[model samples]
Target: MREDLRYLLSTFTARDRFLLVMVVLAQFTSALLDLVGIAVVFPLMQALTGASLEGGILGRLYDVLGGGSRERFTIVLALIMILAFLAKAVLASIILWWSSGIVVRLQTTTSRRLLQHYLTEPYLRHRDRNVGEVISAVGQGAQMAHTSVLGGLLQVLSQAMSIGLIAVFLLVVAPLPTLAAIAYFAIVVFGLQRALAPANRKAGLEAQNAAWASSHALVDSLHGFRELTMHDAQGFFVDRFDVANVSQAQSARRANFLAMLPKSVLELTTMAAIALLVILSVATGSEAAALPTLSLFVAASIRILPSMVALTATLGTIKVGRAGLEVVVRALQEALTSGVDDQDPRTTAALPVTEAPIEVQQVGFRYPGAGRDVLRDVTLRIPNGSSLALAGPSGSGKTTLVNIILGLIPPTSGSVTYGDVPVRQSDQWWHDVVAYVPQDVYVADDTLAGNIAFGVPEDQRDDELVRRSADRALLGDLLAELPDGLETRVGERGSRLSGGQRQRVGIARALYRQPQVLVLDEATSALDNETEHRMTETIRSLHGEITTIIVAHRLSTVRHARQLAFLADGRVEAVGTFNEVVSASPRFARLVALGQLDLQEGPESA
Candidate 1:
């Protein structure tokens, strides 16, 4: 628990820590006011009952208030008590409001930080982890930290302080009863902790895992909804989701039940302690004289009992949430130590707006935990403002090589350089000069102009530039058909647009950046022959204006390239012009023959 608290505190900023201290002070002040309110009850009761107030702090207060008649003294005491109670209530409300704000801020800050960490991580790191688990950590884990960790700790602190102060006052008035009550409460709490610790931990871990699994099930089902519907396999995903949902519900039920148990047990114990105190007063034959002290103790008990119950319940919640807290903390720690410096280079230096040839020399790569290299001593050079096509089998390291060129991942051996500078040394600059269009482009549910202008902020989006890029990608005709033109809203993942239109939107987005080099990784693979040819023509139009690298299985897509490279078994088999490579390598010749036949047959026949 101490370790968990330390980690929780580390999550807070200095300003937040300061606010927390203020909250504690406010709570302590409220508790003191409450104690004063309870202490005054004894004097007020004595005065009303016609008992003498000639001793103790109450007596001193009575003298200060000019005690003369019982009626007058009672009235003054009553007013004092009323005012104190009102003041305490007001302060308590303020404390509640302030703490609520802190919890909200904590949730937002943690979520944002976790998201930033995830975004800044390298591509390989993201591919290695489960997306659902990451989503849960960013969503549910942040909420738990606010509700279970920070909120629980604050509740425990405030209640414990109030309980402690009230107990001390009770001890001053009636030490024996107060000590007995403390001992009983301590025993109940300790025993409950010992008995429920294991179950609480188990529930917490199960809840976290189940939640992640449910999220994974939902995301998978939604992403593959088309396939499931076509194959009538929706029941399989439904059953998987149901199992996870049931487990999560069970864990939540168990946790809530355990949290409520403390209140029930404490209530019973409180009743017994009050009864015992009455019995002790009677047995001592001081029952008649102990009325004032009994009244004070009762008033203190009213506040202290609830404080004890709340403290116990909050402790239980913390126990159940510890597992989630650990997971969130671990993710934050990993992100902090990921060793990726993601600061904007524009802060220090600006990249030159010029084209440069990309050169790869003896580059090799092996995926983490893989037995063999994916790329072995692979080397190539792309000239400035010249098109190069990379044609290879599915597992021949084409995408991997592109990723290295894009500076998304580092090579295991040797290096990739641009204009005599290593890519790693100018990663940010490299990104600025290169634009990539994958086979399937991601389109947000936003306006056509927004999707075309992708990363540019709304206020900064240039309509002229968007139109120019759209025209360059051959999207002018589609835009003309739309009712709202640039303002048309593209459905989620561009569902509103045809596959060809979506690919064109992606090309327009890449062109919007006006990059010095454009990379297309089988970007036209899913289109029909007409769309494929049109997209290829669009690429050909860029010719000498942009350095283009094409990774394609379709021979027609790369036929116009000045140079072509063929890869096999993680090594470059041949690198030359189309006819040169086809003549030099039988493998290249065979692939071209197959590609041409597929294109001639049309996609339906292929």
Candidate 2:
């Protein structure tokens, strides 16, 4: 728990810490004002009742205020009390403003840091985790930090301060009674905490787990809504989500009930204690002399009892939120130790413009915790300004090989290089020279020009470059069809565009970077015949100008490539021109015979 608290505090900046200190000071000041206000009540009451004020600070103040008649003294004391409370109100507002501001900043800052960390981590890390869980951790986890850690801490501190200062004032006014009251409240708080600790902790843990589960289920249901509706399986998701939501609500209810329980018990105890004090004062025959002091003690208790109750409530809330704090702390620690470089100087640097060949030398790759290599001894060369088509059946490691060549992942053995330089050492320069279009193109809900000029800053976006790239990607006709040309809005994930149009947007995005190497991982497989032909023509035009690597299951897409490589069982079966591969490898010939390559015409015709 101590370690978790330390980590939570570490997330705050120096400025935040300073603001926290100011809030604490403001709380203390408010407590002091409350004590002063309660103290004034005694003098005002004494003046109203015509009691002697012959000693103490009130007597001295009475003398200073002309030692006036009781009515005038009462008015003066009442005005002072009002002013003190008014000042306290202002201080209370300041405390609230600062504390709320801190909580908001923590939520936003932690969420941003988590997102940036996720983005900077290696690609494999992303693949190995559940996307729904990641989303939950970043989105809901941040809200938990705000409600559980920062807000809880501030509440506990301010309430505790108020209770402490008020108790001290009571002790000064009536030591014996104050001590007795303190001891009784202490025993009650301790006993209640002991009784409720296990239940609170259990409820908190349950709530945290249920929250994550519900969030994950909801995201999954939304992302797969089309599939669910088509298959009549929406009830499955709804049932799953219903169970999680009910559990979360139950746990929250249990925790909140426990947190509020202390207020009721404290209120009863306070009324009984006040009644007992009054009876004892009257029974001892000291009622006349003790009335002023008794009133003072009773007034202090009236203020202090509520503070004690609030303190207890805040403590209960903290216990209920402990599990959430632990989860957030663990996430932060993992991000810090994940071995991903958060700051890479090369991200903003200029890339080399000279073209170079990419070479793969006996590269083998086994996925983490996998039993066998996905790619073994895969050696290939993509010469500068030449197109290569990587052909393979499913699970034959074509995509893995392309990933290695693109430097997205390191090989388990051997090396991949660009000319004489290792790809990893080039850092962002490698990415700057290469653009990748995946099978599923991601289109943002943005303007057509914005999607095409994706990563470029809005102020730096060049309309001319967008037009040129769109033309090269064969999107000119699509743009003409749009009512707003480049300014047309693509719906979320490009729902506004056809599959072929989305693919063209992906192509235009890659071309806008003016990459030396363009990689298409089954980019044309989703398009219709005519659209695929157009896309293939676009690739053909770049054949001699930019190095192109195409991983294709459709044979027609790669039929015109300068070189072809066939892979099977994690090994390269053959590498040559298409005709040479077909003549040399029986497996390649079999695939062609079985029509697995989806040829428009016979192999001999190609």
Candidate 3:
């Protein structure tokens, strides 16, 4: 356990290392002030007993203040003591305030780093991880790190100073009792440390597992809630979630019960020690010769006990915090190591590409952990100023092909070329030149203008250009109808708008970028016939200006394209003009014969 903590703290960055040092130093200062406060009890006792402060730590402080004036120095000594007490209070408050700020900064940095890594990691990494695990690491990990850093450093300082001060006073008054207190505290802390290590490890695993399970249950059920309701399986999901939560609660309770054991023992041991000291002081008549010694002993015990208790509590918390931080450190290390192969591969600027178009050559891909390839031996070319429509049956790998082009997923074999350069290390390359509109459009809960210009730089955005794009997308009239025009808020996922309106907003977002390559993955399938026709008209108008790839289910949507490719069984069946493929391929001919091509047409027209 101690080794784990050493590794965790040592692994912190240089800035964090310096912060830790400052926290420990501040804690030491606060501890010194507390010890100084404890020293006051001895002088107050002497005043009550009519004894003189002639030979003690306080007496020395007084002599230094008085310059050897033994007589009539009490008044001056009293005033000086009061000033010293106030000074200690002020200094302690300052250190505590500083430590609090340090802790805030530490947690803030931790949260930002984790969130950045999460956003930038490759898509496959997220596929294997649970949303809950990532969320828990960022949320709960920050809180625990903040608390442990502050509590651990402060207590270590407080307890060590208090023990040292009390031990010195006890030795001066009586050696045997001092030795006994030191021995007792050492054993208690050691035993507490030993007993808590296993529990800490267990708690870390439990938190991770429970968070992951809960997240899976929540996301899966919500995403598939309609399906589950149709199949009457909602009760089953609830039962599973309940079981997971109950098991996690039980594990937490057990861990808590184990942590409390050390405190119970320390409390009982402290009470016994105090009783023994009182008995010895009375029986041996040590109070008569140096009755003030009893006050010093009592004062030291009073001050030291709370510090020791705080130390024990924080030690337990530190153990748990260290375990949690190990998880975070491992995640950060993985992020650093996993996605570093892209350096010096390729570069795509934010500005438009002046090179030739993209070409795919013999690209083969299979999902990780899957038994069969989704796309096999695929070869295709998209010219600089021509559009290609991908017409395929469901499960025919159209989405996988799109994902490859976007750099969201890497191919298992073969290479993709942009102009004459092989696509490599092109981070956000698609964003640089390609604007993608997926099947399910994402709508932000912000102004209509904000959703349309999602990726455009604020300073570069021209309102006139944005308005033209909206008109091209057939969404100009809708935005004008709203009270705030383009500034009106769209509800979550554009829930307030019709399906066709939402699809138009998505089209506007894509067109706003003025991308060189625009890929529409069934983006307009949700729209009505009129809206779909308008969208296709606008798309065809930019045929030479932008290279477009449309994944189409409705053949009517692709009749205007220069070329059409029919995909079936994860391979390209045929590629040619609409009538050419229908005449050559029986699958295409059957679809045409059945009038499925004109799905938007009424039955009477068919």
Candidate 4:
């Protein structure tokens, strides 16, 4: 716990430290009012019994209240008590409201910073971490810290203040018994912490495990819902979820039981002490002494025991909070250590005016945990105003190469250049010029215009431009059919649209950027032959206007490219016009034999 505190303290920025101080001071002020309430209890009691204090603190309190009839005095005292209660209530309310808002804001800020870091950080960092876990940890960490750390600290302070007041009053009354009671309470709290520490740790781990398991189940279910429904496997998923829920419940129950044990023991010990005090007061010498002693013992015990109970509960919360703090601290550490000094050089103000030729020079890359390179010593030059096609079997590094070109992955060796400048170092230049249509089209749960303008700035999104891009990508007819036209909401992932329509929407999205270079990675795989043919014609029509790179599985699409390259394993096997590569490379000849290439052999081949 001490180590956790030290670590948490280290994460606080200067501004956070200031907020911490303000929260602490507010809590202390509230606690002081509670202590004052306890102090007033003794004077009220003495006044009720017709006992007058000649010169002590109670005497001063009596003089301050002023002489009056019993009814008038009661009224005055009630008003003062009411005012004090109101003041404390106001303070508590403000503290609680502000704390809750601050926690929410802080969590939002943390999550936003995390997202920015995720986008700007190196690709390898994402591969090393879990996205779902990072988000969950940030959310839960802020909630727990606010509730347990800040709230528990306030509770403990309130309890400590009450104990302090009781101790001071005890000095004027039964000192020995008061000391003994305090000692007993402290011992019980310490015992509770010792016993529950392991339980808190175990419970925290179980909670995190259950969260991950549930999230994994949800992701799997969504991805494979169709298959599951066809197989009638609802019971299987339900059973899996039940296992996680039950494990979480059992762990919580155990932790609660452990936390309660010491408080119960402390309460039993308190009752024994109260009983002994009562007996001693009743048996002792004079009635005056006996009455006051009993009153002091009862008042002090009542005040102090409640505080002890609160502290015991607070101790458990603080322990659990310590566990949550670890997750938050780990996430912050990761974000700070990402070393993204050269990640992206793009700025919104400086947009690329035209596309430049893209060149991959002796680049090589391998996935983490994989033994061999997915792309190796690969070199290619796609000049501006030309269309090129990459043809390959599955696992021939087609997607891997595209990822490198898009700046999604960095090469392990060599570099990619646009014109003469390194692509990574010229992010803004490349971003405005290059657009990608990925194999898996992502249609957001938003309007048609929104999905097309996913990366476009709001101030730049024009309705006319959106319509123009739609027409260019052949999605204008589809949009015209929608009830709201461009304003119509697309269902999640465009599940309402046919596969070809979704693909066209994706193409329109890329075209919306008005990019100088457009890369399509099997973008037409979802469309039928006629749709594919139309889309290919639309792409070919762009011709000298933009540089185009297409990864195609269909022979018909590959034949349209001015140049074609066949990739085998992790290297280029052949590159030339259709006949040049077909005659020179046997690998190309086999591809033709396997019907992987469309040859212009007959008059009907058109």
lDDT of every predicted structure (CA atoms) = 0.84, 0.83, 0.72, 0.72
What TM-score would each prediction reach against the true structure? 0.94, 0.93, 0.87, 0.89
Residue ranges of candidate 2 with Cα displaced over 4 Å: 64-66, 339-347, 596-606
Question: Whole-model lDDT for model 2 versus the true structure?
Answer: 0.83
Q: Rank the candidates by lDDT, best first.
A: 1, 2, 4, 3
Q: Residue 524, candidate 3: how far off, in angstroms?
A: 1.1
User: Distance from true position, residue 357, model 4, in Å?
Assistant: 1.2
Backbone clash tally for model 3? 0
Give the Å error, residue 74, model 3.
Answer: 5.1
Which ranges of candidate 1 are over 4 A from the true structure?
A: 282-285, 340-348, 597-606
How far off is residue 532 in model 3, in Å? 0.8
Per-residue lDDT of 122-187 in model 2, one digit per residue for the tens? Answer: 778867877656666677667766766678778778878777877787788778988998998899
Report the C-alpha displacement of residue 419, candidate 1, in angstroms: 1.1
Best by TM-score: 1
Write down the RMSD of candidate 3 (Cα, Å).
4.3
Each prediction's RMSD to truth: 3.4, 2.7, 4.3, 3.5
Superposed Cα deviation of residue 213, candidate 2 (Å): 1.2
Write candidate 1's Cα lDDT for 160-226 as tens digits: 8888888888788778877877888899889988888888889888888898999999999988988
CA error at residue 14 for candidate 3, angstroms: 2.4
> For residue 258, what is the lDDT in candidate 4?
61
